[model samples]
Structures are given as C-alpha cells and as structure tokens.
Target: MSAQKVAVITGSGDGLGKGIAKRLAKDGFAIVLSDINPDTLKATAAEFQADGVNVASFQGNVAKREDQFALVQHAVDTFGRVDVFVNNAGIEDVMALEDVTEADFDRVFDVNVKSVLFGTQAAAAQMKKQGGGSVYKIINACSIAGHESYDLLGVYCASKHAVRSLTVTAAKELAKHQITVNAYCPGVAATKMWDRIDAEMGKYMNTQPGEAFEKFSAGILMGRPQVPEDVAALVHYLASEDSDYMTGQALLIDGGMVFR
Candidate 1:
C-alpha cells in the first residue's frame, strides 16, 4: 500500500461534500470529487487546486448504477487506490404526506436511499479487491431526520431512515472483509439544502423567510445552527484509523438536538 490515501466523495461540488473533500485532502488523501453539476464540479476543483490540494472531479449522478461504479473506477485509475468513500450526494423534498407526487417521492428516495446502496456496493467491491478491512472505509451521509421524523419531510425522513438501516447492515456484512461502515447524522446547516427546506417550509406554513430555519435551529442544544465543518470533523475521524473500532453505528452529531 502507498503512504498516500485516496478518497472519493459524492455531491462534492458544493456544501457539506466539499467540506469533507477539503478535510480529507488536509488529512493527506488524494480526493476524487463527484457531482452531477458540471459547473460546480469545475469550480470546486479550481478551489481545491488553488489551495494546493490533491483533488480531481468526476461529473456523475449517484442515482445511476453505472455512474456509481465509474466513480470508484475513476478514483482507482487516478490515485491508484481507494481508501474512503463518502456517500454524501442527496436531495430533499418539502411537502405534506398527501401532497407528495410519485415523481417527487422517487426522486428523493433515489438519491438519498438508492445512491447509498449502490455507491457503497461499488466502493466495497474496490475495497475488497484492494485487500479490505481497516485498510478502507465507507461513510454514509445520514441526517438528524434519520433519527427523528419531521413534519412535511416524511419522504425525506423515511429515505434517511433507510440510510440508517443500510449503514448498520453494511457495517455488519463488511466487517468480515475488514471494511468498516458508519454514518454521521448532521443537523440543519446553512447549505443550499437547508435554504430550500426553509423556503419551502415558509411557503407551506405561511411564514416569513428565515423563520422556519430559526425555529429549527433554536431547538438545537448547541445554541447555533450546524456548519459543514462541524459535520466534516466527525466524518474525518470516521475516515481515519481513530474510528476503526467503531462500525455499523449511525452517530448523531447534531449538537444534542436528538438524544440517541
């Protein structure tokens, strides 16, 4: 094995994924940044390049099986090995249960649930081939919603709940191969996802802008809304040897918002 590690992060064009990519880069991992958006992908690559990070970008949709496999292949081809895989690409929907369209439900679940399943499947193959065990890690992007259901986010919550299930199941099954699987559940962050959540909630509940976001943030025992870095810090630990003993655990990093 080479002294340098390689990490592939999905939805890494912006927001939390970008944060994890940067953190892993700082940890001395050559990174493969994957996203569906080409422009953001280029921009993020430029940002990392400016910072002198070992990074590359892959434009792909995580919901597609071929893209998921190609992402892992890209990392191996570029960096020579895959050390970490972060399933962070996800989408959210804000609607009453009765109002959710079939299309909306599928879109949410496809990215949040199916992506994790296939992404992990493809990455695990590489890890197993690379001589598995503590040599590689699989990290899922779970959420506070995964632990506690929220109103108007029924489909999104359920999808994340599925993530929790996959995290545990994958951890148990992959342990024999020496590959550890875990998840970090993040609270509301000021990312575009939360902005959309807040905006949609405002339209649904007839509230002013930022009102919905504030209401949720106020509930956090941490006294502030979470940042991408907060979530990335936990993920960094999970990706490193420090968390090798921990597996199949969906950890809550929501600042005491949800006690689990």
Candidate 2:
C-alpha cells in the first residue's frame, strides 16, 4: 500500500489534543497520538480504530529529547512519513514575578518551549528527508498577557511569548526546506486548562467555572472565548493542503484580544 498523510499530535489524548487528532483522522490523515497519559493514549487510539481511522499511540514526556525522537521515528516506522506535527502539550504557572520560583519557570519552559524546539527538530529532520511538512504549535489563550501582562501569570505569558517568538523564527528558518512552522494562539478557551487558570487566578468572570465560562464570551472587540473544537477546526485547516502557501505566521485564533 502507498503512504497516507500522517500527523503526530503531541499531547493529543484528550481535550484540544483529542479534538485535533479526531479532526485530522476524519480529514484522512493517519493519526499518531502522543501524550504523557498512557491510558488516554491507548483509549484515543482504540476509539479512532473503532471509527476505522488509521491510528496509533506513543507515550512520552514532552520535556525529553529522546522521547521526542522516538515519537518522530515511530511515525516514520509505522506510517512511512510524517506530514504534520502539532505541539499542543503545555502547563500554566499562575504566580507573580517574585513568587514564581526558578523551578516552576523552568518546568513551564521545559514543556512549552524546550519541548517544541526538540519536537520541531525531530519533525523537521523527518520532513526534510521526505521533502517537507507542516508544524503547528497550539499556544493557550494567553490573554493580553502574551503581549501585555496579567496579575499573576507573568511566567505563563513569558513562556507563551517565548513559543511565539520561536515560531516566527522557525517559520523564517524553515521556509527554505518547505517546512512551514506556525502557531495558533487561541484566546481563553473553555477547557481543563482554563478551569485551572481560573481557579488559580480567582474570579476573572465573577462566576463559577460554568458561569464564568458563559460570561466571558468576548473581550472588547473579540468574538467570544473559544471552545476546544473551535480551535480544532482551524488546526484542521492548517494541517491540510489548503494552507500550503502559509508559513512563518502567528495566526491568532483568539477573539480580538491582542489587537485590542
């Protein structure tokens, strides 16, 4: 049999990751699920299998190079080649500048930035061998914080800003090889991550999780706070042949927070 389009979505066993993986599978891209969560990893794979989509799973810590290497290598070994890579695994640290410990900052950078670097390196090596591919980094809804500042999320914003910078740099650096490196910065999406952020940062919405979620629909001019599937739809587009001409851009999927 000939090779099918294959995508490896890191941290894709649940939430946004799972949504992206399922979308890719539906789009006919063979889906390779990677996450630190082994049980969810297998469950996602089996679920896709039941749907008759080509699927597989790999468990790896995003902060580790060897793990990243294995995931890319497995993509090649199992599916012939990788056509897309999504770096979607991340964590948030909600402490002020002074309260943010070195260890905490390091941990955030390790997963958010370092992992993407190595993961991109691994994907690029393979993509280069196979001609080229696309890489998408799913950055959180960093609020105005990514560009400005929030009360207790300096570290988280810093980490995302780092990812944003790295993405632009990679776009320019990788263009020559036909590898498109880009990031999707979605504003506040109602997910587990958002729930955690809300709990730590206090009532940004003045309501509980569900209540707050509905209240904070949009910032000034932005449409609304997003859902995982909302971001997933855009990710689906970027991973396809339709976005071949796009590269080296930080496409903001947020409701207009940054421009405001």
Count of steric clashes across candidates, in order: 1, 3
Q: Candidate 1: list runs displaced more than 4 Å.
A: 132-134
lDDT of 1 by residue, 173-203 (tens): 9988889999999988989999999999999
Lowest lDDT sum, 10 consecutive residues, model 2, at: 134-143
> How well is each residue in 98-129 modelled by candidate 2, as lDDT tens digits?
88787998999898888888888898888787
Please give the distance, in angstroms, between residue 72's alpha carbon in candidate 2 and its true position after superposition.
0.3
Give the Cα error of residue 112 in candidate 1, in Å: 0.5
Candidate 2 lDDT score at position 207: 45
Candidate 1's TM-score:
0.98
lDDT for model 1: 0.92
What TM-score goes with each of the models? 0.98, 0.88
Please report the candidate that would top TM-score against the real structure: 1
Clashing pairs in model 1, backbone N/Cα/C closer than 3 A: 133-178
